[model samples]
Target: MLYRVSVSFHKNYLTIKNDSIEIGIMEKPVKGKANAVIVKQIAKHLGVSKSKVRIIAGEKSQDKIIEVMS
Candidate 1:
């Protein structure tokens, strides 16, 4: 099971590692790769499980609509 998430990614990663990927955004758009970090942060703040958040759409756009499910 999975869920869709929408967010903007900015460079928050201090160092590149295989196991750890960092992403962050300020209330606005930032230039960076849209990865799991952003999704995780949003999900956590939303009080939802990480597994419930996934990037189902809008790979290169700002306005993204995510589907929430059980």
Candidate 2:
């Protein structure tokens, strides 16, 4: 599955809305810390391994494209 994810820093939560996902991450975007948490959170939510979820685009921006392999 592919998703367009919008990231925000408020709380730790992930919400799936249609083809988009709204993510509220607690970790700061430092040295990929927030990205790591995003991957982990998505993987956990989908009941998949961390390796299965990947950020295909926008690694340095608030909006990201994510690809998930089953």
Candidate 3:
């Protein structure tokens, strides 16, 4: 499955609506830290492993595209 994600910093939250997700992450967008958290959170929410979640686009931006393998 693929999802369109909008990320927010300094807050911790995860919401799913249709094909898009709104994620409020506490980590800063530096050195892949925030991205890693994004993957982890989404995986947990979807009942999948971190390895099954991948950010395929928008690594440096708030909006991202992620792929999850079932």
Candidate 4:
């Protein structure tokens, strides 16, 4: 399924809020500069594989699209 996420990127953290669903989490992106680190951290929290989470769109922008497998 596809999940639409509204993201807020901070200097050291990222908060994603989904209004349509009931999910809540404010996460730190990473200490370093790799985008992969943020992705991995979120995937781990969601109990999904790293490969299953992707910034399908808006990699550079705040709002993003994420696909989670069944």
Write one digit per residue (lDDT tens) for candidate 2, span 1-70. 8999999997878899898999999999999999999999999999999999999999999999999999
Model 1 misplaced stretches (Cα beyond 4 Å)? 1-33
Pairs with backbone N, CA or C atoms under 3 Å apart (clashes), candidate 4: none
**What residue runs in model 2 are displaced by over 4 Å at the alpha carbon?**
none
What lDDT would each prediction earn against the true structure? 0.48, 0.96, 0.95, 0.55
Q: What lDDT tens digits, residue by residue, belong to model 4 across residues 1-70?
A: 6666555544344444562212233444444334465567667767889888776775654455667664
Candidate 1 lDDT, tens digit per residue, 1-70? 3333334344342222342323345434444344445565656655788777666666566544444344
C-alpha RMSD in Å of predicted model 2 compared with the true structure: 0.7
Identify the candidate with maximal TM-score. 3
Stretches of candidate 4 off by over 4 Å are: 11-34
Error of 3 at 38 (Å): 0.4
Residue 16 miss distance in model 4 (angstroms): 7.2
lDDT of 1: 0.48
TM-score of each: 0.45, 0.96, 0.97, 0.56
Q: After superposition, how far is residue 22 of candidate 4 from its true place, in Å?
A: 11
Question: How do all the candidates rank in terms of lDDT, highest first?
Answer: 2, 3, 4, 1
